[model samples]
Structures are given as C-alpha cells and as structure tokens.
Target chain A: MALDKRFIGREYGPFVYTIGAEKLREFTLAIGGAVPGAGTPGEPLPHVSPLLHDAQAAKAGPYGDVIAFPSFAVVFAIRPFSAALSDPEMGIDIQRVVHGEQELEFLDVMRPGDVMTSTGRIADIYEKARMGFVVVTTESRNQHGKVVVTGTWTGVVRG
Target chain B: MPRTFQTGDTFTHVRECDRYRPIYYAGASGDFNPIHIDPEAAKAVGLGGNILQGLCTLGWAVEAVGVFVGDPGRVRRVRVRFSKPVRPEDTITFQGKVTAIQDGRLTAEISATNQRGEDVLKGAVVEASLE
Candidate 1:
C-alpha cells in the first residue's frame, strides 16, 4: 500500500457532494436492515438531532442552505482516499481490507441548509499489533472556508 | 428521566423492526464481519447467535428520518452513538421524534431498541428543506 508513515501530512482534495436521504434508506434496506418506513420521501422524519447550544455558533457553521451531518465530513475525503490507494505506485489490495474505525471532530456546530466543502489530509499512521493504522483527518468548511466539522477515518490494513 | 413522544412523531421501532437479514447485506455493503456472517464466530464472541454490526444498525436510523426530511436531499446530517449490540434473532424498531424546526431545517432524535427494550444505538439527525 502507498499509504503509510510517508503519506502523513499529505493533504488531499476538497471533493464535495450532497448527502441524500433515500440513498441512506436504500443502504439500510440493501443490508437487510430497515427502520420500518423511515428515510422515505414525504414520510415522517426519523428522530435524529444535534443540540446546538448556541444559535449564532450553529448559524456560522452553515453553508448556504444545506445543513451537513456529523458523519457528512467523510464524504469529502472518499475521493482523496481513492486517489491515493488507486495511485499506480501504490498497490493496495482493497479486497482484503476492513473498516477499522471512524471518528469525527467538529470545530464548530453544523446545521441544516449548509452546503459544505470537505478538504482533508493523511494525518497519522501507526503499526499496531498485527494491524496497520491509516488515519485520514478531514476538515469540512463552508464556501468561506470556515471550519464546520473535522472527521477521521481509519482503515485497519491486515496484510 | 422520562421522555415521551406524541402521535405523528417518528421514532425507531426497534421493537417492531425485525427480520434482519445481514448476510445478504454483508455481500452488498462489502462488510463481511464474521460476527455478522458466521454463526459459529458469533457464538465464540458470546453472542450465542449471529449478531449484526453497529453500522448496519445505523443505516436504519438514517432511513427512518429520511422520509420526514422529504427526500434524501433534505436530510442534512446524521450522527449516531452505539450504546448496545444487536443479535440476529432480536427484532429492532427505530423510534424518532421531531425536536426542533429552524427555518427549513428539521431536527429529530432517534434510537434503535431491541424487543427486550434495550437501546442498541442512539443518535440525532437533522434535515434541510428544498423550499
């Protein structure tokens, strides 16, 4: 894998995309898990919330009209991870991989109607017992580059 | 503390939502956690029966709010915390409630509970409006 201690401190693209609800539903359904009639169009909203302790802080985190989710930060770095692993020089056998862990750190609050831009970098790498830890930390921002959410996705490579 | 939801309020029917077929999902999502697939491995883990991963359960929460948000596009964000575990034979119900409305944003609280009345997961979701 071209991913290791060397890639640390390397920043990746600011790929952006909108989070869709039905896709979320389909994901659950495809996995043989369904929340009854949840995540459907015009269906009653499912119970999910964020406690915005302050209105102004939440407002500042918004990006135009699209409010972003806490996990929404990962979408931004998906492309970067692909590019790095897919690099001709880096032969990452993705088939034998497992999603080790994922963590999100928010610098500011996120609200609905906020369109965000996610930019990220390979933050840290460590060799654990029988596992290689690859960490990518991402920063989500508004059009103005204001920080919204910071996310980290870890892939535990077992070769 | 006691929290209550009224009629028309959406919540995870972890009790009613049952018949989880995770093996098919394991093939689709590329998540083949043996604890989810191999019943024997599950027993090794003290599950006695096949158990589902927390992420698979999170998918339920994401979809439950997706309908109320009016299109996946409206669903702005979802964050979940894994509180407990879900087993294969255990039926899960997603329960939700709209806690706030900020202009075009709808915020709801949701959780996944097993038939035994234990929360397998807990989290909040927020949605944006096309309008």
Candidate 2:
C-alpha cells in the first residue's frame, strides 16, 4: 500500500536533546568498534581519535573539549525521522521498512553541554520501482541559535 | 607542518561487524529496532538474520574521511545510499579518494564493500574543511 500523500507535509518536532560528555564518549567508541560493558564503553580502538574519548587530551586539543563524532549527531537528529515512521497516520509497516539513504551536514562541532533543538517534516512521498520512499529533512540548532546540523533521511517501504 | 591533500590521494579503513556490534550500536544510538537486535525478528521479516543499522555503516564512511583529513571534527558532510544489509561477522572495507578541493574544503568519494567484495554502500561522498 502507498503512503497517504496527505502526510507529506506533516511535521514532527522541536525535539530537545542535551549533549553529555559520557554519551559522546559512548557513541564515539561504539561506532569505533568498542564493546561496552556495565561500567565502560570499552577501550578506544587504534583509529579512534583521542579528541573523541579522552577528556584530558581533548582539553588540550583545538576544540578544548571532547567532541562528538560527526555522525553522533544522528543519535539525536533522528528523532523526527523516527517520529514520522511511527506516526499512526503514516501507517508505515516497521517490519518492511529499510533505511534507503542518508545525508548529514555538520556546520560546527558539537560539544558536551550543548542543547540542540531539532525540527523536521516529511519532505516528499513517492514510489520508485514499486517501493515507497519517505524523505524527511531535519534542521538542528544549538542553544546559541546556530544551525549545527541538517539531515536528509530517506526510508524505503518494501512492497 | 600541515598535511597536503590532492585530487587523487587515497585512504582506506576497515571494520568488522562483530556478532554483537549491532546490539552495542543499538544501545548507544537508541535505535533498538528488532531488525537490528533480534535475529529471529529479522528472519521473520525476510532478512537473513539480524542486520547492522545503516547509520552505523554511514558512520564508518564518515570515519574513513575523518581519518583521511587527520581530524574527525573537520568532517563537514557525508552522503550515502545503503545498497545492501551488513550482517554479523561481515568485514567492511572503505576506500576513499579525494575527488575535489576548493575554497578550503575537500571532497572525497568513498566505496564500502564487504569481505565477499559486494558493495554495501553506493555513491558515498564526504566533505571536510582544510582550515
């Protein structure tokens, strides 16, 4: 079944997320191939940058603090896209959905204590080769009112 | 001394999707969708078994460029199309080549492939600031 075009312009949020130092380390390490346990986010892999996991080292680096890995923005920036997929009106079958594509632009580095507010809307709805595609565009602004990140998230609903 | 990058410079990064990596990524990213954490659930949906979140693969693509540029914070943009699912134990290799550089920004095209040489991500591109 095709998604209702009526939901094309539906908006999802002004979702608020506060960046924490530990969460930043966790996310960076997880994607950097660290295995986490109850008390640790695992040891940082060789390729993992110290600026991302070591607070002291980061404090001495250019950013002056540990920074979230660029893609860590997705941890919070995905709020609106998640909302759209589970929105009852959209009636998207979660089981049949696959992330088709993704694009993210980081305007500035995200650091701990930054408060980010993100809002997004369904940018388009169309069928391609018998599969339905839902495109959502999101903008996240930091507490300083500066745009920190923008994303284009696409989800494919398999027929 | 500042490192110089040219239009044809290339770099590579390799990562393995260990059996529990998807579950660990799910915990950190807050994407607990059963397809990523539950093998049976994924199989029920016709996926061979549990699959890693596409965003994780995207992250690796970004990591490749981040490593190339010598700083993760310098990575400014990344775009990717998920061509196939990455299953547990699959090792992915990312090869990136600088495609352009102008106005203090550098752009690179990246390719992500699995151990079997199957492409898992298509048209992957990343941009970073030189300054």
Candidate 3:
C-alpha cells in the first residue's frame, strides 16, 4: 500500500513514556558499550552513566537521580510514532517500509524516571522518483512543556 | 579560557555488526519489525540479508559523536540518510570530520560504510558547547 498523503501535517497524539536507567544499560551492554563512571571534567567516561550527570537541577524525569544513556532519548517519543503509523487510514505497508533516515536533536538532558509526553505529527509527505517519502517528527517534553528532545524519522515507501 | 577550534580536525571509527546485533537492538527498542530481525523475512522480499535497523545504526553513529563531544547534551543536530542497508555479516565504518565551525557551533559530515565499502548512511551533524 502506498503511504497516505492525506495524513500529512496531521498530529496523531500525545504519547507518554516513562524511561528508566536500567534499560539504558541494557541497550549499551547489548551494543558492546562499557558502563561509564562519571562526567567530571577531564575524567575519562564510560558508555553508561553510574548516576545522572545533570542531577543537581530541578528536573522532571526521575527526580534527576537515575542517569540516561546518550542515545536514550530516541524512545521518548516512540509511542506517539506507534500510534501514528498504525492508523488504519494511513496506507503504510509494514513490509515494504524501510527507514530511510533519522535526525535527533537534544535540547536538554533528560534523566531516568522523568515523566514526559511525546507529541507526534506527520511533518512531510512527498513522492520522489518511484518511491514515496514520509517524514514524521515527534517532540518530547516535560510536564512543564520543556522540550527535552526532537526526533524526526524519514521512511521510504516502495511499492 | 576555551580552547581554539578548527574545522580541519576530524575523527573516524570503523565497526561492524554481528549476526545477532540487529535483533538485539530491535528487541530493546520495541520495534519488532521482522525485516531487521528475521533473515528469512528479509529474503522473502528483495533484501540480500537481514538489514540493520536505521535507528540502531543511527545509535551507533550517535555513540561515536557522543564520545567525541564528551557530553550527551553537546549534540545539537544530527541528520542521517540511509543509502543502503547494513547486513549482519558486514563490517561497517563511521567516517566523520568537522566540516564547519561558526559562533560556537560545529558541523560534521559523517558516513557509515559496510565491509564492501557500501555507504550505509550519509549524514551530517551540528554540535554546540554545553558550557
């Protein structure tokens, strides 16, 4: 099925996610990263943080106690992605679907245990050559609406 | 005082995923797409082998940049284009270097290549100082 162009610019939903530190460790370990120690200046660091690095500030996630992996922010807005892609009205075929690209921007560091929400939107829909490109952007923020991260996914639909 | 920066300096790291690495990332990320996890599922279509998830490969490139910047928050922007899929038995390398520096922001051109030197992802990133 070809991607539904009508869904372009339509915001799907606000998906909530509760991230943890252990899951970060699991990802790092699985990817062959060693647990990192601390972020002290001039000190060599590990792949996983022993404790939250920016824990001093008044943070929303996890009381700023648990640490977050470097790439952990990707999941912050994934639930909204699930909802957007699974919409029946969208004709995205799960098989022919291939992830073409991803760009993530971190505005602020989010620690584990932070309660946050991800708002998703179909940012762009276009057809180039014989393939279709669907770009989806999701924004994750704290209860206070402080932007934590922005994740954009570009999927290529080849029929 | 902050250290002087130049655009000519760069870093590159080469790596390859094991036969099982892709599936592990999929499980962790809760993206149970069979194209990346199941070899047979991939072959049923037109893929030569089970391809790595673009996110997993992105995570790897992110790891490379994360180490270079020394802080997770230092990364301001990252753009990646998956030119080809990364198979399990293939070795991939990430090559990147500073492309531009302006007003405390640094831009980098990055790419991941398989064992056959097939470009997996062509991308760029902009990083900023955390201080």
Write the residue-wise lDDT of candidate 1 on A101-120 in tens digits: 54444454344444677767
Model 3 C-alpha lDDT per residue in residues B19-85, reported as the tens digit of each score: 7777667756777788888888888877866888887777767666655655445667777888888
Taking chain B only, the TM-score of every model is: 0.76, 0.99, 0.88
lDDT of 1 by residue, B1-131 (tens): 22333334664444333345566445434456676778787666565766665555655565566444433334555566555667667777777887776675566777667778787765534443433
Query: Per-residue lDDT tens digits of candidate 2, residues B90-115?
Result: 99999999999999999999999999
Query: Would you estimate the TM-scores of all the predictions?
Result: 0.50, 0.99, 0.84
**Predicted structure 2: clash tally:** 0
Of the candidates numbered 1 and 2, which has the greater lDDT value?
Answer: 2
Which should have the higher lDDT, number 1 or number 3?
3
Write out fnat for all predictions, comma-separated.
0.09, 0.83, 0.54
RMSD of each: 10.0, 0.7, 5.4
- What docking grade does candidate 2 earn? high
- Sorted on TM-score, best first, the list reads 2, 3, 1
lDDT against true structure, model 2: 0.94
Model 2 alpha-carbon miss at residue A153, Å? 0.3
Q: Which of 2 and 3 is ahead in TM-score?
A: 2
Kindly indicate the candidate among 1 and 2 with the higher TM-score.
2
- Candidate 3 per-residue C-alpha lDDT over A1-159 given as tens digits, one digit per residue, 9 for 90 to 100: 356678888896677777765665555554543322343112213543333343443244333454555467776566666566666678666777788878878777665667788888988888887788878899888766898788888878776
For model 1, the superposed segments whose C-alpha errors exceed 4 Å read: A1-159, B1-20, B45-49
